[model samples]
Target: MSPSNGIQTVALAGVGNIGSPLAFEFLENGLTLSILTRDTSKADLKQYAEKGANLVQVDYSSEAQLTQALRGIDVVVSTLPSGSDDQEKNLAKAAKQAGVKLFVKSEWGLDYDAPNMEPVNPMIASKMQLRVELKEVGPPIFVVSNGLFATLAFSSFLGSLDAATRKAVINGNSAQKFSLTAFEDVARFTRLAITRLPIPPAGSSRVLRVQGFAASFDDLIATAEQVGGNKFEVAHKSYESVADKQLEPSLEGLIAWLLASLSDGRGLLPQDKLTHDEVGFKPSVDIRKTVETVLKA
Candidate 1:
């Protein structure tokens, strides 16, 4: 099918944080959707079915069931968790066998193609491996790079700001900018790409780069303080300290590496222009408003 043909039927595998919103976006765009879930008994999963989505309960390990569920899907969006590489590979193979036209991978973060990129995060390393494997045998893939999810940046994941303690950690240069996208914006842009992105002629795929906002850590801290109506006690962690911590073998090391990467601007979009220009859609989320909402929540 050509890009001009447009997407009609879409299937989503793994509807959690990102997938749930993407499924809603697909339905909001008036596209036919099939949501594949392992647990149909969950209230959230049932809610989608109640709202007219075709819910297919299947085992991720069952290739036959996966292929059968994806038989008529024009596009397959996998929003599986970071460590679910094997499940993603399985879905890719099923999509190829089921003749799905497009396969959107679960990459909603930093530009994997950035220069001198290293697998500091094990999840990113797994994603890189999946990309290579899909290129060789999977269906046509669309890689969406939406920088860091704004929600995660302010959460405990990056260690930049602690909502609980009302504390902040500044890594390296406080003025270095980092790209961020609200989770809602990610869903909206993804829906546009799946339904409207032009199909490559052949032997090619699409890489989308998008960001909701870009600001320095200092700026983010200020935003947090303004939104939360409280002053945070700030501390500094040098890049060398974080980088050295990253060299250790543990989850803490992984998080340290991630902080160092974001501090040094290694895992962000290379440019300021949003990929929405290519899709002809404008993102509407404001970073300040989003931070305020998150803080209030």
Candidate 2:
């Protein structure tokens, strides 16, 4: 099938943070949707069935099982966590066997295409391996790369900001820029791409990039202060001090590399590359708004 053929069905694998909202968006649009899950007994999974989804229980480890479940799916979106590259690779093989017209890789962040790009965060290794394996594979794929999820712009997990202590840490200067998008907006834009994008014959490589708004680390700190109506103790560490070594496979380590990339120019989209406007989405939340909501929560 091609982009002009229109989408009749969409199957989403993995329903955590990004997956849950994406499932709801597809169902809300009244599409024929299938949700993949390992367990059918969860009450949380039942909600989508109530919302008119056909939940298929399948072992992601088995390519045959995933292929069978994906038999009639026009699109397969892998929202599996970044660490699950092996499963995603199997899913890709299955997608091809099942003749899935389009496979949407969970390409939500970073400039993976950057020259000299290292797996600063170990989780990114999954994406890197998938690309090397499938860059020329069939069942033309789709990727939507929006910088940081706005909800995570000031994530305490990154140790960049401690909301409780009101302390902000920076690597290098605060002027390093990166992008952020609200999670719901990501769902909306993914839906748009389903229609606006074409499924090229297998062997295609491309990425669709978008950003809610471009802001710097300093912008986040200031936004936090304004949103919370409290001042913060801020610190700046040299880039060498921040990213001189391999990051451990922890949330804080991954976040540190991500922040360091911003300063070194590996964390953001290029000037002419942003396509959110072309895809027709204006993010509902900006830096200030997301910080306000997150801080309030």
Candidate 3:
């Protein structure tokens, strides 16, 4: 568990999968939380208000609205998707002007700053570009690079061909090792970092690459087999064969880029110098646990 140093009053930009759970985690930690949404009367956020989050209405497109919404906020945690770089940039600009103490960028996936990376979707590239621009901002921004969400991959999207079938289709080999963090755990870590000190100086733009466990896809398959009480068949498909059919053709290029990244072992997490011992974030969920839960589900 990460310690909170009494800093409260934080804001979240996007409150979807990771952000929704993150808001709950922050509330659990007793932080004075607020969320900026397109609509303030959203029924989804009503429960969050009951949980003690001040849901504020903001026109995500307007700079004045965002700036005014963030007037006295101490920290900002942005979970906006990669395609929303423009919104993130606007938020960064506003946070800087508002004298916010910390801003956590919406970099929950791969480390886009890694050297010699191939081009991804233009939108993703724009997000990386936003990081460089944020460096010029006055407040310190933290970039968290947790590989993949175990919950997401285990869901029907990446795991099975169909939800009902529970048939997992692997592109290449199931033996490729990758680091996976649970969505809930990612939220927990984000809240912990939000209320805590900026471990690495804002000038350096610290990157926290945290993961609960690193395991191969074969490990997940075997675990699924054990939990299902039956041996499951592993179907291997070429990236070319499944790229267009399984994924949208519009996103095929991005899919191939991400697949190549996994094949090259870029999906594996590097040995980060800032661990729980150094900073203070140790996620409790592991890939095996995530796999087990998916199987039971």
Candidate 4:
């Protein structure tokens, strides 16, 4: 059935981190949503079901199941994580066969289309592979290349120093500025694209790059210091140093490459009027603001 506004059903694959928040946004807007999950036993979905979501348990690894789940859906928003490129490829194929309209690939980190930026982890690999496969899909698909989630910079995963009382092991100082987008805002943007973006002409590839805020690593530490109301110990370690200490080659290699690239400014978006105009997002949180929120939480 054709939606009142041209697009009707939206299916979101994967409901972790950004996906969870994004799904909430869609539900809040009173849209018909179909979500794919591996774990029905996970309690986090209780609220989602109460909010009127059709949460389906499907194996991304199985093409038949994905195809069945995608039937009758008009739009597909992939919040699926890395290492699922093959599944995504299969889904895109199914979406095409099912007459899907818009398929958004989950490439929400650094801009893969950037001149110097390179894919480092398995996640990026899966994303890139899906992009290539999307070309052959009968329907139109788009990629949203949003820079690092601002939250990542503050979280331990990104190396927020976990020091006893004095020294924390952090990758960089507070001075290095980077851009970030809030989860809620990402949801709004996704909705806008689904509901408002003008369709691209017959045959064209569309890419939307979004930025939230730009600040340095030092900025984050300073914010933390202000919130904690006390000076914390600091330890500076090079990405190479972190790699040397890691025992696992895969883990170490991935971290080393990411660290070096981040340090080298490979993922840094170009600072220009045209670039900003093209990306079209003004983020809500600055470094200090983000730190305060984290500290309070």
Candidate 5:
């Protein structure tokens, strides 16, 4: 790892799927890591505490609790999911008050920064709004514009693919290029962002557009079929119709909206100028490997 980069203690606001891998990355890098959550009884939270993380439970509604947890933290990262805007706002306030040097926004999906990439629904809108509010409320906001979590497309809940049925579906024409990032790669890139690059302070934010690889859902299906020794029949959906059904709110609804957002090619990262080369993050997994993982699971 590169020498400190002026960051000493790193604190995370939540430790879900994204946060879990990210926290481990920080810890493995020898950075001082703290995990902030409201629940200490969770088995996962307990594991972090065992792994040398300062796992502190706090009531997000209480400013004192938030402030106390943030004291002496150099960077405060929100890995909470999209809906927790209020929690993120409070965390940013606490980070600022505690003199944290940077506040990282919890955006681990999509190139929503791309042109014409409007929010398809309230969830995506909330994520975008949180980034804006964080700029006004916290230290420098660090955003990684990773196009999509590679695992999302293969998830059973997203319903894009069925291993048993050998069938697959996608938003867009199934050939619109978009970036896909693995969770561990996201963590590693994020670690690089904080430790190996110049992070801005409050009033000015930093955005890095990075990806594991760029591929279409068709590419993913091909990869999966190759890895699994089977072929997948494919179907396509439009972004407009898929976005409409997601207003009811469910896992299926959310993925439908996410898939729809990709229809117009807004899902893609700029092919000419991806930030991975500048940031120096060589992804550990690509589309084929990511697909292999999902097919196995």
Candidate 6:
């Protein structure tokens, strides 16, 4: 830890959808910020640099470069896209070599601890592999199991509610509940957790399951209808039926797998309790407001 603030420098890797927002949250919370990206020419780098983030460009495949970039960092947050499991493992190895205090893995959603749960896609399988690798590494780890991102829930990304079509394809029973957390909320909670949570002893870490809201497919459709002032044409599909149809090769297959998993309660976090409350933080985003914002967008 840096002597000045008690908590030393923080570094973020792969500043994409989740990473970018998390970077801003860390910066806003008054932490020394550094960003690692393979490409320096990305336009967002300029914005991050302008906001006082130290931008370090490095080849993800080069362990030497990664070790050098992570040197002297207190915490490392990886928001790398799914399927980059090898890269995440390599980065973890580099972080451990560089003596990083904490490494927050790239698990932003789902309860990977679920028993007998199989990966619905290659990306998910890679994430599971990273978890296994981290357990053998040196740095203290933190995993945030924040169910489905609210942004994806309202968008077509999850294949649940289609905003453009004003249609919802509910899988399994519409009454089955699941969790949803906004990108901003996840970033906020992450900032708090990384900076405030006590560092566990070596070979020990915590998985914090948090969410902004919990709702069923029927609840989501109802929220959409209420927000849009129009009833959406709802269609019910069995989880197996939808999963089989989306098995064709394409990105949609991945989406279908996620949707079906959520519908079947495979990857979703438990909704019976609030992890954020247990940790003394409150999430303010509600399902109705989230739907309205998405509809307005």
CA RMSD of all predictions:
2.4, 2.6, 3.1, 3.7, 2.1, 2.8
Alpha-carbon lDDT of model 2: 0.78
Give every collision pair in model 1. Answer: none
* TM-score for predicted model 4 compared with the true structure: 0.84
Please identify model 4 stretches exceeding 4 Å from their true place: 1-5, 39-41, 118-123, 163-167, 172-174, 201-204, 239-249, 273-281
User: Regarding TM-score, does 1 or 2 come out ahead?
Assistant: 1
Model 1 is weakest, by summed lDDT over 10 consecutive residues, at: 196-205
TM-score of each model, paired residue for residue: 0.92, 0.91, 0.88, 0.84, 0.92, 0.90
Per-residue lDDT of model 2, residues 1-297, tens digit only: 233457779989989888998999888886789998898889999889999999899898999999999998998888888677778888888889998888888767766775646645776765766876865553687788887787775676566777778888887868877777888888888887886666666777668777778888888888888778899999888887668643767665676678777777776677587766766666777777888777777
Q: Cα lDDT of model 4 overall?
A: 0.67
Reference-based lDDT, each prediction:
0.79, 0.78, 0.71, 0.67, 0.79, 0.79
**Candidate 5 residue-wise lDDT, 130-185, digit = tens:** 78887887888888888888887777766777766789877557777777889899
1-297: candidate 4 lDDT, tens digit per residue:
122447767889878888888788888886788888877667988888889989888887776787788888878888766666677777777777776788888777776667766535554555676686776763677677666776676556666544224335655333455557677666766776676665554334577766667666665566678777867677677655643433333655555555555555654666552133333445566666766666665
How many steric clashes between backbone atoms does each model show?
Answer: 0, 0, 0, 12, 1, 0
Q: Could you give me the TM-score of model 3 versus the true structure?
A: 0.88
Off by over 4 Å in 3: 1-6, 115-121, 159-163, 199-204, 239-250, 272-274
* Deviating ranges (above 4 Å) for candidate 6: 1-5, 116-122, 243-253, 271-274
lDDT of 3 by residue, 50-130 (tens): 988998888767777888988888888999876787788788878878877788888887666666355455555766778
| Candidate 2 vs candidate 5, lDDT winner | 5
- Poorest 10 consecutive residues by lDDT, candidate 3: 241-250
